[model samples]
Target: MDFNLGTCFYILANYKGYRMSVEECEIELRDYDGEFLRRDVKTEGSIQPEHEVRENCKGCKRKIKLMDEGCVFGCCRVCCSGITKKISSFIGGKVRCCDVHNDRIIKKPTKSVKKPIKKEYVKRICIYKSLSQIIYTGHGADELLAGYGRHRTAYLKGGYKEVTKVLKNEVGRLWERNLGRDDRCISSGGKEARFIFLEDGFVEFIQSLDVTFIADFELGQGVGDKRILRRYAEELGLKECGNLVKRAMQFGSRIGKVVGGEKGDEEFEKSEKFKPPTTDPTKYDKDYRFDITLPDWLPYLQTHGYCVISSAVSSQNTNLALKSLITSLKLLHGNDVDTWDIPEHGLISETLGQSSGAWLIRGSSIVKSAFERIWEEKDLIVSMDCVIIWLSWLNNSNFKPRSEGLHLDQNPFNKLDMISVQGMIPLIDVTEEIGGLQIIPGSHVGVLKEEFKDMHGDMRGKGDWCQAKEEYVEGRGGEARLVECKAGDLILWDSRTVHGGKVGSLGGRREGVEDGEIARASVTVAMVPRAWASEEVLEERKEGFRIGATFNHSPHETGTSTGTVKGKLYEDYIPIELTAEQRELL
Candidate 1:
């Protein structure tokens, strides 16, 4: 047998587990060869058992798949389903929120920190820009592999697991509403503008994944999930109501198609921008109050990028990035990990880009020093009332040097500044987590009540403003609307209008905070018309107030202030000061 015609089977075949005819065994061997070829397809470009294979992701050309000990090929490693399983197995902790973040952080000195550059030219456009949205699958990054929170919940509820579909839809919806907000705000020259929409909804064609949804949402349910969202709000100290739900506005508005469905109707009603709900403001009266502000000083503010408000429309991405920043900064501080600092001053960081209510007051310190001169001296020269009254007529953009603070002295670049009006400058940041200020609109132009009527002198956040709201602001606790803005957002309002920051709601934002918390953060400045000053001082103040609004102070609010000029002009001119009777006409 060894020499002559030894069958290829040899002798061990009779001893093997299965004893079959020679022909049958040949077929069985063919089957094994086929099986091997199938298993090897994932490793090699072709499934020939003899070819060499490489490690890579099956779906992508170059992305390497996450491999297990024995699985080195893309077939078993790169798919999201596999990735999700691995992540779940690794992290078994509880995630309490879908809308809130709680990582406090401190900013570490970057090896090379780039300063904000002063602009050479200012671009002004009308506030009639239309905004659009792009809705992509947040689920792919959001829910697919690891974040099966809602899907996981769906599995528990009715066993009809549609996690991927729901989230993809949700992401689309959020984009829609976000675009709406951008449209309305920027249409009024607020710098929250949009130019396009993008979407990805092909996932439904993939296998539907099932999981337990983590969020048991009972929205508009006064206090149910409110606490979860508020807990993070507490860390941040949100001044406005916690509309945490805006996170999904992009998905809701764009790719979900459901949001797409609603958008047609939303776009049809032009007047809906300012119309109030039939009910009251307190009672969840509407979807979102799209109060498009026609800045009282349209022509004046137009010299800078006043009308160019760009909403990132990537709110979730921006917020999560903030969480990461907060966490990373805290780690660097060597402080309690959960405790972080949020800069309550400096408002420029509110908006992520270089536009609108936020502007970089950085460059030559000489320029900064000059700017600070405007800061400490503004109110004394420009009657705060006159400045307030004039904001309605000017470009009403950043209004740098709106107010002074601790950091006012530390900005190594030019002295940074911020300004806001009764309404808020909301921003949707995509870069980091820290967000901007909040304010109550229409708090201005309203008179104080019987009780507060006696206290109408100095303060910005309290005193007479509170008294006015107690009586007039029906539904918003007082008679005022809040400006819930995102980062990179600069808010401007009438000076008489009452505004304040809700404690910091964004975690990683301010550099010093671990779990970000503080007052409404901003680099504030108020711009006043030269008319507010005495004729003698007006010449000097005019240089700073109206000049270079186009280039020197791009984001705006570069006001003129001469502390020395104030008292000196009052002395030399001897103009009759306005008494109560004379003030009424003004």
Candidate 2:
């Protein structure tokens, strides 16, 4: 951190907004200026330019006016006149939090927050211990209006295959398109900028108008796209900003892009580590016990049903317990919620024969009812277990379970944490969408339980789609963003974290009939006890924690996604190019 200005900023945050001193600024200015100055390296000696110092040092430059010897801070010697003043004023003033990122120009990385306090509303004085508030620019025109390629694309693509290919590519492009731009654009004003996009793939080779960009559900093929969002953006008050093709994210302050660029050659779907068909995902379970990944507190999800497993319990014991649980409530014991329960908790009782039964159990089988209920939703919510179970039971609707094993919470019935057994708590599985579970990073921190509206206090105060119903999430400024991951990669999120489905493909004939059913395939999981578990598992399972994210979660109005499956294996069907070594070994 080098500073490049004549006057440095001394941010003494007091109640009367932030305060600074003339002397302090004078002293710190040198350091600040040093941060912006470029230096020349020499063994014997060398003569560099004067004005040549303007450009930040790449190697060596003809001009070296700013500073010959580099300062402690890696300075860029950019000599824009008022640039320093703006930097000084920004650093010097008392800033209020905004729904945007404000650290774009600062040396520090600014985090996004729920909302921004306007200058008039800010307190004049703050305490000495207070830190400078960071801010971001609003989402700009995109915040209010949408600009997906409308009907125009339909005309460009010659046929179904061509259109389908573009559709697939669109979703993948999001990772690259939003990377640098979102963080940079919003934070410049010390405000936050964020948006959501769901697509069957990419769109925009279209460019429609009186038409929309994203398709709505009724449109089927056209609906899977984000045309609806563009329409929503316009209704909200955002304007179309020119041709609005996606802009590269690297243009702004997001450091991740500088550290890492898109590895287009690699396949994202593969990171999900989807398995091939006929493979008993459990067969590879040499160390862990469950079909899913293990947590640090407990390597194997060995069925202790009770908190403590007898030291003697073997892998067979855990397997038998899992099998028995499946026997009790075929879908529930599997730890996946099938369909919306309405008052939603009823299924818990239905599964464990717990009190939730009335709310969830439809008839002989909760699984059957779950599907029928999902058939009602215009929008689908999906997770991993939903995919697995849908496939497992696709051929056998008649195989209804008599009951689920006793809820470990009750004995003879006291078997498991009722929450864990029932899967009422949020458990994250990255496969729900190829992008991994979406989250509002740091949205969890800096919020008081009282101020928090939903499970997570929203930073943007924009939308609620991730948590509440369409009306609720949008009403509260709830936001979402996809976190990309590799297959087999285990991502641990807070139980309250909110996420939704990203549809890949759909089609299920009710009875080998042909195509009457539309299924949204995904995976799922449940949280269990073991205080030492959450923290321990993440460190042991993942290579490293790339970002420190405090998630936002809402318990009320929270609903789970529907599940569906295709006979096709995740590995064979995805457009992935495996490593050469993998092929040779195969």
Candidate 3:
């Protein structure tokens, strides 16, 4: 073949080990500046190029590696060293050539010689090389294309409509369930991944297609799922690939077998790493009461099943009551105390209930006034049977008081005509952060009773006290609300309302002195109109007051008292003097 110098250079650079006969050729080589290095050379030869053609250096007559000096268009660098600017302008591309040295010229070319190419060109080549290292994942395809066995199950059960619904939900949550996790795993290796099926435009196109067209369950297995995609693959001559069966990545790689065992035999026991540390129940048993703006008590109570009366006892009276109780406790249990160690049901010693301190709290004119307003009746009798005291020490200890479960003080099987109400007086500010009482509002309006019956067998008249199921309290329209109060405030609830106590950390305290101080202190009391009680119940109430006995919350019942105080007795306990109004409670 007859060829010019440029054709010869191209053939020599690209087609290695090729032998061709060049009958005649006009050889012309130039510097980048177009200055002629050689012109109109004639040749006839059978040329067999072993590798790259090496040119002889004009200065030393030694053959050099092709473009080893970063020369432009294969020009001899030693002979044209001073023509860099001219050569650069002629090439019209960035060219960096090495400095020529007389001592470093190669006497004989070797196969190990490499060209010094421009850095920008090498960077471009590296970018193309990186493309080959990428991993392409078929992540979002399965979600959008009905590729799972579950999808086949859905199709069999409900046809295209079910499959379409499943696909929509899967695609909607793909980013949350799969894409994010897969991307994190792949990129953790300093590599990258691409999800071609998840591209926004491609996803939208697939979603726009009719479900029947996208998949055909009747076609069976491999051909049944992703029917449209398989057909398109076949059209592209990927017949074998198109016919391949689908396999989950975990199953295909056998990772599931190694990591989690057989599909149906996977064990999902709770991990100890996620278990919560055991908390000291006594640490949160302390009491709190804070003064807040009072709402209209009767109306609010009627609407919400409970209401808080701010300053139900005067601050001075509250402090006196607290001091009296503390003094009684000191007299009975000594001064250095960690907890009152009261009954878990929150019923304190009957002796403590009848102590001068308890009488002072029960006789507070403010408390009576609040109760009178609530019942709209002047003649009221207090439940002298049960004086519940929640007294906890500041020391962090595990002494839990009162079951946290919601319960009713009155039996639902009984007549609903009684107007009895229960109350609590906090000795410190009670806030959400320092948890206290929780109540379900409006739960006393007969609706909760029906729900309770549905959940538990009808136990009408079976018992007077019943703890509500947690599910009933947490279900729709049954969420409980916290009742926070300040010192001396009165929190009252209907006997039928669902309510419970919640212990909380006392939270902030001064560094040194207050660290082991009182964490929580509160008193529970209840009252009802005297007319609601029978003569026998009235006699029992009077006898209870005489013997310093404690009872539960019912003012009209005779047998509700916890009988005589059982544990630890104070023989010399003296009762506090009561006013005429307090005297009527007996």
TM-score winner among the candidates? 3
lDDT of 1 by residue, 1-586 (tens): 1111111111111111213454543443343232211122244233221112435434243444333212222222233233223223333422111011113121222222222111111011011112232312222333323233344344223333354456556655754654454444333332322232232343342224332222322211112232343444556877355433233422322222212223434545546566754522222211232111222223212121022121211233334433433343344333552233222223222111111112221111111212223343212221111111001101222211132210101111122123222222232321223323333332222232212233422223332222223333243334332344444333444333333333222233334432223223322333333333456454433432222111111122222311111110111221123333212211
Question: What are the runs in model 3 whose C-alpha is more than 4 Å off?
Answer: 1-295, 385-395, 400-404, 473-478, 505-517, 559-573
Every model's TM-score? 0.24, 0.20, 0.46
Displacement of residue 534 (Cα, Å) in model 3 is 2.9
Cα-based RMSD of the predictions, in order?
A: 29.9, 24.0, 32.2
| lDDT (C-alpha) at residue 160 in model 3 | 84
Model 3 root mean square deviation, Cα atoms: 32.2
RMSD of 2: 24.0
The local distance difference test score of model 2 is 0.26
Ten contiguous residues minimizing lDDT sum, candidate 3:
119-128
Per-residue lDDT over 398-447 for candidate 2, one digit per residue giving the tens place of the 0 to 100 score: 22222111111111111112222212111112232222234332232233
Full ranking by lDDT: 3, 1, 2
Ranking by TM-score: 3, 1, 2
Question: 28 in model 2: Cα distance from truth in Å?
Answer: 15
